[model samples]
Target: MRPVPDRRLWLLVLGFSVWGSALGFVYVLHSVGCAFAWPANAIRLGLGLVLFVHLALVGLLWRSYAGTYPGAPAVDPTDSFLNWVILWTLIAAFVTIVFTLGPTLLLTTCT
Candidate 1:
């Protein structure tokens, strides 16, 4: 059985990391915009643009390495589990960003 390496494990969390970064960045953007009294349209546009960037990031991560790591060989239980976890994390991160952050677009900002 091929044992999963410790160092490579970090790849599993990459999806969540990107999502978290996006969340923090967007929060900062909103706070700054509100503090500066940015017009409603500008704030909304900024948020939308940031969200688009995050979504694109998550998409790239998923596309590049969701499952089946590079140079991986025959099936092994540990490798299989790791691959599944990585895939789900990416999926969950994508769904979460959409569901949680999407509503902000519809509602009034800085309310």
Candidate 2:
């Protein structure tokens, strides 16, 4: 029988999965809005809100991980992997937020 993963590992995986799913959802929302000729301001506002929520969720995840596992040891492979995954996920989400906001800020109307 295969051993189940640790709770922390499961939490980390679920957190990142949700983060990635949110990113994709935002993209879909923007695309659908554009396709349907929604007002630029409306679409931008909605996307911005979604992005803000995503950032908040990711921040909470980071805080929770830190609180639960204070001063994780460097020698533990799972801890190190989880830390790296969380870091990269945050970076990716930040970059996505910037990309999504850029067009909204630069263009007043959908082209």
The model with the greatest lDDT is 1
For 4-103, candidate 1 gives per-residue lDDT tens digits of 8998799888888888887897799889999999998898899899889999999988876655753466757787777778877898999889988887
lDDT against the true structure, per candidate, is 0.83, 0.65
User: Which 10 residues in a row give candidate 2 its minimum summed lDDT?
Assistant: 66-75
Off by over 4 Å in 2: 1-7, 69-109
Candidate 2: clashing pairs of residues: none
- In Å, residue 21's CA in model 2 sits off its true spot by 1.7
Model 1 TM-score (2 dp): 0.85
Model 1, stretches more than 4 Å misplaced? 66-73
- Per-candidate TM vs. native? 0.85, 0.61
RMSD of each: 2.7, 4.5
For model 1, how many clashes? 0
